[model samples]
Target: MTEFTEPEAKLEALLGIINSSARQAIAEYKKTGHGVPSADATTFHPLDLATDTLALKKATRLLEGAYHQLSAILAPPQHTVMNFVFNYNWACTNVALRAHIADVLEQHPEGLSVDRIADAVGLDESKTARILRALSLMGCFKEVKRDVFANTRLSLILKSANNTGCYAHYHSRDVSKYAGVLYETMIDEEFSRSHEVDKAPRVFACRKEGMEESFWEMMKNDDERRDIFHRGLIGHSEMMGTSSVLHQYNWGDVSSVVDVGSGIGAFSMPLAKMFPHLRITNHDLPEVMVQARNAWEENVPEALLDGRVEFVPINFFEDIPVAGKDVYYLRHIIHNWPDAEATTILHNIRKAMGPNSVVLIPSSSTHSKNLAVAPEPMLPNFGAGSHRVYQIDLTMWFLLNSKERTLDEFKTIAAAAGLALTQVYDLVETMVIEFRIAQN
Candidate 1:
């Protein structure tokens, strides 16, 4: 057996990953000419604001993967297993987001006393202190002085304005409820065998609230929830560093692109900003189209002034996209549906493709490429470092009866839609898979 496959080499392998990955991250920071970020940094590093984070994420993947593996390997099994159950990190983060603790703390650049902070947000002093202390342990907040909390770089992400905060709010509030019922959904007669969106744990949990409609249907009907949800998608992209695709993909060669199921032009706006020559189309339901236009006007107004962008409302399962575009880009779309619906969306796009048109599914491309191959002696996909991805895979199951797919799983669906997978670009956060119309 290879050393990587041997049980004895695990610890040694982890240490190597930790050392090398940490060095890689240090190099990324130094290359930025900003040195490395301090643990107590109060604001974002310049790299944090950069659209390209391929190097940073690459280093992080290894660093995160190794440390988590080492922890799991060395820590007592009881500590690790109970961790799956006794975790209150989410609950504490929920409190921080809901209370707008980050916003309040932002006013006190130096720091704020727990009692005063609690009074400012109108929560009990001791309870606020407890939650802050808990999250502080995880680096979300800093205890500048005993019972005095300050915003850290991580805490800034929890601010009311940040998209990651919105993402967290939705997940912590709604997704958590659905997750609570995951076991019940697994064993229940009606939901157990169904892969339909309506049968999701989310719908089951909210059965009494009359959440009988599919996730998309419900989103379509509710304006407020839909707005928050779409904004969260933008936040989702930022947190995932998906904007790197603009630099990674060969957009310069493509004349035009369509963002299918586009939510407020999250991907397309940045694409348009970065590549001014490429014509862009944003497609979604009618309401979301209105949103996309407004967002484009606000964020990519230059594109609007030049009349280079178009908003086309689409129901992807039934409607073919605007035809003959160089690319039909679906960012974070297919993963929200089960095989049947996902295939239908692809089929619809397939119908729109001219001979040269390519359909791009950017979210799941890494599995088919080198990006997902962990360093030897580590679990492929980078065990603990990839913890979030696995958690998100479960999140899809809980919320929509959908999932993240392995390459083969994604290809099976693509084949069913009469498309052929043509290329794969492994962006650090997600993979961008390219497909073309199948040759019969």
Candidate 2:
């Protein structure tokens, strides 16, 4: 018989302890509705306060022991297999299979045999069964009996026709375009440069040529596809609109506001509805403006539409409509380009702004830690924030050459455009940086 190595023996011991402790914890929770405490919970250890003090510390000890054993086992050659399996399982189980299984179970509330699900979704029965089995192992669905599946809470929510079921559309083709670009860039380092317009064909050539033409091509004249894209934008806008920065703006003081790059009137329409007295001009490319008008006519409240909202076709980079307005709102637009182009967009707004006009650029920010090398702050003391924004910055690195910039970086761009940053209000992961024309 082969002798087990120290690390292997330790791993086996740790697994046993973990299984035993986990069972205890679950049993305790089920019976008493409280978790077992860590060994150091009552002890005078610095980290004791982070654990519960009432129960035995067996659970914590098992976790620490397991980590130590796993660290040894995970070194060098052993780690590659673990990493691949972990990532593969995460993508299939967490991202795809779980969602698909939940949808199937939800649609067949009476519970589904694998064949029924395959038939309903027009998938092969054998493939459907395999997917169901995989999801059942992940606790997304339950095998009620031999090859029969029933909805768990997770699966039931996935079936709803509302926001719950909307995950399918969110992860559909339109949004997946970015994901595909990112994945290809990750696998083939050469593909990284492909995202640069000069280096490769424009990825969004469909939209770059003409949004209307792109829309028809991308959606293939399919109403459902168009609606999915629209819903994804609406879902994203709803989250952004509810943020405090948007709410904190004094829209009452602004009579007319123009939303640059106002796709389907997500930001402008909401602003118009919120401030009934404030007339909003949803400006975009001619094609996008058509979509915006249709979206507004369908979704925007009638009360807000009584001459309060207008759809204007204007290429922001070329020239902004000369509207005397109190506020010029640009949301999520400036980040799409490099500083030079972004500055040009801002300059157009600066040229169009009236004296005392406020330009509200509701943008995102990033931190220094997540970068490959720490970036020098564009403005002193402006990069102070959370790591999530940095994650978004990295994401933009692949999607486009764009980035979520720090306050100082924003100020530098605004300065080039002849605008001065007056105030910045941080609201729920976004910043509303108010700017005005620089005084000569």
Candidate 3:
């Protein structure tokens, strides 16, 4: 019965949303019997490591969106604008990831002095302390005592072996560089009006530095960078909680699945494990296929032995995937290219589809009003709650001249590929959009 038309009423509504969503998140944590995580906690909570975090994520989306909206409204205009312009947390996080600060702190549960920490990581003492202190403000690392620091739950994510850490590393170091030239690329004649992959801000930035290999070509040539990129992808899955689709979707109905553009089988490997009955095929370029084979051999050799999984090397732009699978799942693939290339990829997959086959694209559908929207008094796209969705869209724009699409945009591309949007599974940060052949 409450109308949220006025600014005061809306603020009250957001506060209520914040309170309710926080309680929901706490309840999810308590459901695990491990209680909620403390701000200063050094270790991960049990739920933190669990595979299905959809409930927690849902609550968190609202909680994040509401509080951030409340803050923007209450804070001074200059302060809010400056916060956007002056944020350099990415640079600080990059330093932490590259320097292995969390790995160093892991050995010191009681915390370590800045001097010892710097010496261990070979960073200058005073400057390193500044970085740690900056990150500590956001609860990443904790200043346990004067001039000493210890890892908190957030900081533990930056440890070298963590998948999500790998993702953060790549984003912070590489993507940030591309992002820096956004304005220049927008105004440049050759790049400004083109949607070609080579016209991306990344190409512009790289050209400035006299490095000229395309992103994929560069990845193909560098073994270490390629390895890190693939691992970072798994971390990307973890960060976006894309793998939660395993539990949310009805895999029981899917007997076989072709993982289109599958990098190292991040989604398929777990899918195969969870539903042993699924005949999973990974489709990627030859080099990625080799890596995917090794990953499968090392991680889930049993699935291979049982004849449940296969690796099919493909240049998805040109190659049609294996014919007639129940599901052709493209996770985080389409967003890497512009509309024309994306349409071609989907159309190629369309060629391999059987009458009943469905192409599942789990992607960041940026600001799709058809999907989740905030109630009145809050930004419709949930503002900061949907922060990653918008950022990833920009990331695509920067790196490849591509972008995350709206639901209508998705349908347009799907229609061009002779497919129609059939279903959408809203999985918090991203959604799994199901497409099938268009009817006459």
Candidate 4:
């Protein structure tokens, strides 16, 4: 063993003393629920591990407090590293990886060596190894050995040609088109300001010359892309849909239900299936309604499609044609606009709602303080304390100038629209804010 110098030996001795003191404190706390003074009280007053257990407890609490404080200081760097790892390559790298994995696995269902996969996908062997390593860390693939890789459950999903998996439009160039704009928005203030109105000018401008499309608009244009977008929304809905007031809602009293801005009828179709007696009308833009109608006809039962569910094409901002529905369900819609615009949308629905009708707005809650009930501590402590929701809030800010709101904010918006907040249901991260027309 290498011998230590005098300074090093002295430092080691100090650390040993500290460790002994801590251990003694812990033992005292364990034994008597308090800490006792050690025999060497003059030079090294080790904690009393016998009777003074509270001292040990206090030290443990202090250590926890210091750890959290240090974590708070280091959080920015940690977040930066994570963002660099995930957000780097503008999602193109992942798309390319998915495509290459799928192409290779299609030929060799048994499994292909790393070199063979690289050759099949037209990638350099070393570069492929690096990419595969990254993907393996992300749980997208399994590493059989040092450089060899095999398809995982996630990889298989990407390899499938059918619409079943989340990979249908994973490689869409259109999806990656907004990456540059998003990147610029992160670094440059001027570009960030411009992105507030025109999210993807290159793509959105080409599609419709001068018109600006919200982030969702570009994603919902085509079948494959719409499927991918809806899959993501379904994931989000599943997470937030738990708070849905539909269970507490009296579906028996309602004859018809209108789901406004119902994209591909994820919310409406399920309601129709749940309540066979209630007729559900899915109202959306003409393009979306076309897809919704096709999806409903193909996926829903023939009997339900015949009369129970109808796809109506209407610009909700202009006018709502169908009226007297007992329940008007709006999920993940109101949070997409500022208060004034959200109120306008709500007012239009109110115009179509009867006196006794209940309008349900299922939105993610922005209440950060209430997150004390969360089992684990939420990250960033940004307004709502949820990193996912906060990221979405920023995405909304840059894309549509909309915002996710707190419960009080929702209530205020309802009041502005001459609606009363009847009940608020908390569903995990999502909230169902039920409203009725206020009596004069």
What TM-score would every model get versus the actual structure?
A: 0.96, 0.62, 0.97, 0.67
Ranking by TM-score: 3, 1, 4, 2
What is the descending lDDT order? 3, 1, 4, 2
Runs off by more than 4 Å, candidate 1: 4-8, 365-371
Q: Could you say which candidate leads in lDDT?
A: 3
Q: Which one wins by lDDT: 1 or 2?
A: 1
Which scores greater on TM-score, model 2 or model 3? 3
**Residue 166 of model 1: what lDDT?**
83
lDDT of 2 by residue, 1-440 (tens): 33446655646655665577577645544444334433212111222222122222333334434544455455676674565455433333434333455665655655779787777667677866666667667565677777787766444434434332353444442334554455544455554554443222224423344543332244446656555545545454433332344457676666888888777765676666666777777787776677667777777758344877777788787986556788888776787677888898998988888898888887654432222221121111122223334545654553455678777888899999999978876553456788999987
Model 1 earns a TM-score of: 0.96
What's the residue-level lDDT of 38 in candidate 3?
A: 96
Clashing pairs in 3: none
Q: Which candidate achieves the best TM-score against the true structure?
A: 3
Where does the lowest 10-residue lDDT sum fall in candidate 1?
363-372
Which residue segments of model 3 deviate by more than 4 Å? Answer: none
**Model 1: how far residue 122 lies from native, Å:** 1.9
- Better candidate number, 3 or 4, judged by TM-score: 3
Candidate 4 lDDT by residue in tens digits, 1-440: 33446654634443453455467546654455334433212111232111112334333433333344334444697774675566534243455445557557656544568898888777788887777777667655657677777765545445434332342344334434443355554555544444344433343324445545556566655566676665545445443333244465667787888889888877776666667888888888787888777777777766254687887888877886489888888877887766776888888998898888888887655554443232112122322224455555654554454567877888798888889888875544455778899877
Candidate lDDT values, in order: 0.86, 0.58, 0.90, 0.60
lDDT of 1: 0.86
